[model samples]
Target: MKKILLSAVFLFSALSYAQDVKFGAKVGLNISNLSGDVEDTKSLIGAHLGGFAEISISEKFAIQPELLFSMQGAKSEYSESDVDYSYSEESKTKLNYLNVPILAKYYVAEKFALLAGPQFGILMSAKEDFEFSENDNGITDSGSESIDAKEFYKSLALSFNLGASYSITENFFIDARYNLGLSSIAKDYTDEFGNSTSLKINNNVFQFSVGYKF
Candidate 1:
């Protein structure tokens, strides 16, 4: 993923010299979640800010490359029951990432365009905040904790983007996109019983943005 992103940057740089390039900055809202091998997860609200370069290759086609700082993750609640104890937990996971997406844009109309691309992400930080309660026989206990969880996850994430952009005016635009996860970001773990399990978690995000071209 790193190599692919690096090659794309070089390609974009070369194209910038011959193409009609327009640079822009954007700020956005992200509705994110986690999917795969997990249950009881809810969407988490986040934000993303980015810069992009659109290189026009023709009247109706262009290539856009973007660099963004994104916040993503999910909230979950679950319970476990056993003969000796009953336990319930609620957690919110927060992940920060630096992402690069190289998109192909097809102008469907003069003011509207469709976008599709591959996004490469490097995880910058990960943390989990949780509250839990356990009842052992007749005894009850409850607590909450905030922990750094970066080491438990893979540092690289890969996703595919599908969306559209509308040019509201000559220098202003609005975008709506869905980023679908294509790679698992969770690492394998060993349980207390010494059995190893491979965890699968992927990022699912919906984004909306407003931008101005410079």
Candidate 2:
């Protein structure tokens, strides 16, 4: 990322001198999940809040860059049964991130625009809630674990976003977007047997938001 930051800075400087520059603030809901090499996983509900600048390049096009704090992750469940015993487990992973997205927006209609861009995310925190239950010969046992999950996840993630925004008025708008992760979210390491193993997981998130321009 140094190159990305440099490019953002240059673009921001160029756009700052343009006409029709608008600033806005937004808050949104996120439905996030982990995809690839994982089973029994479901979407995790989260939130994101941020600010953005819309720099007009022409009558029907602009560059929108945003800084956001996002919460994302997934819920998972696993179960197994044998003739004499049954076991079940559930887990929820929480990942917090600071995200920057530089989007190119094209006005498709008078009040609607399509947006697509690359987003870079910096992981802030990771945690998990785990619960397990077992039944053997009519006896049952249950337990729970709260874990710090940062060690299992990578520090940075890259994703691409595609979405649309509709303007409700001159200053109010609504947005819907889907982010598809391009980088593996987990770290690579060697196992006890000197074999390399890594969890190949990527983030998938759907976002909906409302915004007001200032």
Question: Which number leads on TM-score?
Answer: 2
lDDT of 2 by residue, 84-117 (tens): 9999999999999999988989999989999999
| Candidate 1: tens digits of C-alpha lDDT, residues 1-214 | 5669575776666496545889999999999999998888999999999999888888888888899999999999999999989999999999999998888899999999999988889999999999999999979999999999999999999999999999999999999999999999999999899999997899999999999999
Runs with alpha carbons beyond 4 Å of true place in candidate 1: 1-10, 13-18, 78-89, 132-143, 191-194
TM-score of each: 0.85, 0.90
Q: How many Å off is the CA of 168 in candidate 2?
A: 1.2
Clashes of each: 0, 0
